[model samples]
Target: MHKNLSRWREGEQAGRRYAFTAPSPTRYPWQWYWDSCFIAIVRSRWDRERARRELESLLAVAEDGFIGHIAFWGRPLDLERAVRYNVVRRRDLTTRTIQPPLLAYAWRIAVGDPAAEPGIAAHHRWLGGHRDLDGDGLLWLLQPDESGLDASPKFDHVWGPRAQGRRRFPLLIRRNRALGFDLRRVADAGGPVVCEVLTNVAWSLSRQACGEPSTTPALVARLWDERTGRFVDEARGAVHRPLPPERVPFTWDTLAPLALPDLPEEIGRRLVEETLLSERFWPGVPLPSVALDDPAHTSRDHYWGLRRYWRGPSWANAAWLAWQGVRRLGYRAEADDMARRLGETVVREGLREYYEARTGAGMGARDFGWTALALEMLSPRAGSGSGSA
Candidate 1:
């Protein structure tokens, strides 16, 4: 894993010494927000200084608490890719969207880097102020990609198949930069907003890492579907207490809230037995991005550059996040089991971007960076993070 991670590392690109690892050398040459966070978590295990510098390089482009998703370091921004992603080399060349706010957790776990605190706090404030269109405890995602479960069927109801809104990824940066990324009028005009599950779970955990308290109204009241026993995306309107059978799409994010420490005892345990450790997601591999019984579920890596990247593959980052929550909730046996299988999968698959959830077949980009998190899952402190933070 370390060898693969080192092979994918990028540094001194485009006349800069900023160092960070690309998710894949061939497929994903650019730096990604959340991918860097996950990689840094494992990179700390090998060399803490390198991990710190990696995050520092990733955050170099952050301004006014707003961080874009991708940074084209060695590559130059061109007319075609620029128009497609809405970025220009001369004018802050990165998309305007944010990924999961995991920097705080990564920094905390990597040993309290104070440099990340202000930006982390400001990023949370940006989300709280700009998102949450309804001010519910749950936050709204202006675009599907912001949740990082890109192209998952869980969002088909919002943007149809393949998350059509992704085409607008670049526009957010232009508008925010024009408006100074200020508190008011942050969201682009006429974009759809849904209170997504994964973003809120990350929000819940990262906010705690910053030592910030959660907002009012409570996520349980807005996002938790008691009837379905999973977290569902809420697109405006109060979720009735009892959701009808199969009322919401079940995807990997269904188990994401398990990472939240504040989750109730009954809720967390049920999430463990009925969902995380259940046969539905644990078909053969430890966890699949989408539940096995979901109508859109599939374990094949049919699409790569096109879309639908997260439908049913087993992602190392997803497993690490679930393992964090599962172990925190006192299900060490199940968490350890997942860690063992995940480490073996990494060994068998050789650090690909994602693997087949059911058969453990390698898929997506090879020498993928975050698959290194399988090692973190096997660490002694793997279960150290709390549902509280």
Candidate 2:
């Protein structure tokens, strides 16, 4: 396992060095905040000075308190023309869309210290600027598709215009009609349900920003499904269940009350334990966006970039996030067990963007975000009890 891990880490470092040169000597490609955050997390384990530079670099790219989404080599991707769909344009500069407010949490984990006063204050101010608290107080996400890499079909609906200029990938679905693999026909397929990790993260951040009492009524209402005793994807409305059932068990959903200091403890605990760990939800792969039980699990036969579909694959980021929340609530034994399981699986199967839920087989970009996440978790410098961040 150690040998495999070392080889994988070398591959990841090489990929990063080659694929990601600072777009410019001075500027950054779109603000790539979450990506930068993750890079910093891993880099901190290797080189604290460079990790610090990565954060400072992100700050360098911020404009009007928000990070732009697309930065070319090091400069911002040029958005000189009106954004168009299916048309090749000049420089693509549509960076307003945001991912999760994971920078602060990830920074705390990576830096291994409480953020300084200015650093903490700056992040909070930026969070406030980005948060949309209308009269009703519901935190409306202007562009929900900013949670990079969930690979949902419905993203075109919510973020069509902003996402237009970006490269688009074909979504292929295959169904076994009790005959064989038929790529032509797929049943019960529609646009993807909302699977935004950042929106959920925003809910978590809001609680942290507000002193960790209770989730605001608006955020709670967005996620609440009184009938199921669980949070559903907000964009899908009440009709659609949250895809990736395994993640639903993640303490993020339960931590909502703790973060906001709202909701009944019993309700949160029940949802955390029963539904999240239920056989129907927990896939053999362990980290699926859509659980093993979902009908759509096998429908998407291929992945973006001609790669295989990881939409249903178990992912390290989701697992690490779950580990953090679980341990925070003092579920130490459970945390250790989960970390060992997820880490061992990634090490054994080889790191891919995701893993097959039923088979534990790995697939997707070889050294992608999920794979890098696993490496970061295994890095000894990631800190004790810091299963994954």
Candidate 3:
């Protein structure tokens, strides 16, 4: 246990120590949501006190429970200034719109650690309720970026008015299609407007909070089209009138199956297999993102340049979701393998805000939530041995 504790300690300290970075060539950094989740998970194993501290540190700095996406050496970052760089916040402009909800998930895992219980409960209570943007009982994505398919053309119509005209990169039309990103509307040549990912994940959390069978299944099933291999927006339908077959499926599209609790075994297998074949889904790399594969898949530099925010890239957050689906289907080895690769990539790449889909390289802000989650997964203490799924 001590050796495991040591490993946990090392992992937690690594996050705490590396948590801050220079905002740019000169500014300092602070703990982000992704980093906190990683730090909290690791801390829960060896030192519950540290886990609570991690959340406390965040709360002390947080304004109204909505933590900022980035900070400079413990000071909140001024993201508005970074808009020129295409760094987006949730609609609120306070935090990065789309972080993996691993914090809630992690808290659930660590609740047994008495020191962690209060903090975990507090955070959960903060996130437990619903925000009915569409008035559909399902939560709405506060920001398009929260969907992790940022600036993808699919939102040109869906979210254009609300996002204030943030559209997909012009170059993504060809590359996204080529990479197999076509199946998902988020990669539409036009840009996706509405975000379903955040809303769905929120529903999942809501179910967890209420301690009831998931209602997401009914919502997901409503979106599923027998005609198409992917799910469609219940409100807008497909972005393209005669939607391209390849454009309909994205990594989030695959999540529909996992969210649904009791589908026929064959039906579940088919969705997974389809996702595997979708070139845009795997992108020739182990990492999974909103886009599967497209010719103009985001390159690390392209993303940093805001040329292809969500057109294509292996996002750690999406990888976490994909891993969940893989595990649900008894693909434990594959899931763990992915967790290791993603975690190693974050450390090796010295990650920035995001990454390039064409190549598994980091881009955007350094040590952003996606990459940070990857690091936490690599922690020896962060497995089923420590808690439940």
Candidate 4:
């Protein structure tokens, strides 16, 4: 564990452009929002000053409370590539959409108070206004990539063949970015627009941590499906109903709301009993990104084709969040079991981007930042206690 943590420390970049942990030295090459959040959480356990610096660097680039999904090292070619691929526009160095509002949540944990930070309060305020797209108090994902699940089946249909087809990739990227990278605009473009469950939950948790009012009540009223015992994605715009259960993509992201420490008892209990402990999600390596039974579920060896990315890999970051949520809800035994399993996977597979859900085989970038973060979080010094929700 100490060796893995050393790799993460060695991976840190400091001095000018940004003092943040890169997700990986090779594949990722830049600082990502949520990745930094998790990284800070782990860093706080040992080095509070460095953890705080990591977040402060992110806020340094914030524009009107909107932190771009990723911050590059500002090379001319990188900037040109981002604009050409529509990953980011000329006006901003970051991507078109924001990542999960997890910075505040991590801030409160790393520092004593989230609002104590220079720009955090403003960012929190920015989210309360701009991100509530439909005014239902639930946040919407402007693009599938913003959800951080990327190529998950939840977005397979919404992104369509353009997302998978190499020929159409550039066109799809431009179209999504041109639409302001917003779900409402996608709806306007005759594409499916979903009020993502995980993004809103992360937003609400950030609000709570920052001493802002709770948005979970409004989110529950808006997205929780009492009949289904799960939080379902609601379509944006005039369709004010949760999508059908069959239509809703069952993935680890769908259950992310479970991580909220203050989640209502009834809602959280139903989620634990019906979904988290069920055969669909709790079996095999456990908490597979896509349920094992889902037709879209893919194993690590199968990731080479159109069905790659978040289709079925068990991401340590996702598992860490879920473990924190479960522990917060007083399920210490279950949470500890999950943490142990994830720690073992990292030890056996090395610090990779993610692991195959069932086999625990490492995949994607090795020495991955977030995977190392997870190991640190589960380390003895970090303790098994829950984090700020």
Misplaced by over 4 Å in model 3 are 1-31, 42-47, 56-102, 111-130, 133-136, 161-195, 209-213, 232-253, 256-267, 290-292, 300-308, 336-355, 365-389
Q: Which residue runs does candidate 4 get wrong by more than 4 Å?
A: 2-17, 74-92, 163-169, 179-191, 237-243, 300-307, 376-389
lDDT of 1 by residue, 272-348 (tens): 88987777787656668888787788765455445457888888888877777788877778888898998888888
Per-model TM against the reference: 0.86, 0.64, 0.62, 0.87
Better model by TM-score: candidate 1 vs candidate 3: 1
Q: Estimate the lDDT of model 1.
A: 0.70
For model 4, residues 188-265, the per-residue Cα lDDT tens digits are 776545677788888888888877788888878887878767776665533323347666667877578777766787
Over 1-389, each residue of candidate 2 has an lDDT whose tens digit, in order, gives 22211211111221132122131122222335566666666656656665565555545545455644443332323343223211123343324445665555555655644345255456556645444433333333433334544344333343332222224421111112121211112112332224343455544543343344333455556666666665544443222344443334232233233222233456545654765466644545445655456544553435342322334566676665545545545566765666677778777776555677667677654544425566544443434333222
lDDT of each: 0.70, 0.45, 0.45, 0.70
Worst 10 residues of 4 by lDDT: 5-14
Ranking by lDDT: 1, 4, 3, 2
TM-score of 3: 0.62
Pick the winner on TM-score between candidates 1 and 4: 4
Model 2 residue 367 CA deviation (Å) reads 2.0
Q: Which candidate is the best by TM-score?
A: 4
- For model 3, residues 226-339, the per-residue Cα lDDT tens digits are 665665543343333434434543444454444333444555566666664355564444454455444334443343343445555566655654555565677667667767
User: Predictions ranked by TM-score, top down?
Assistant: 4, 1, 2, 3
lDDT of 1 at 332: 77
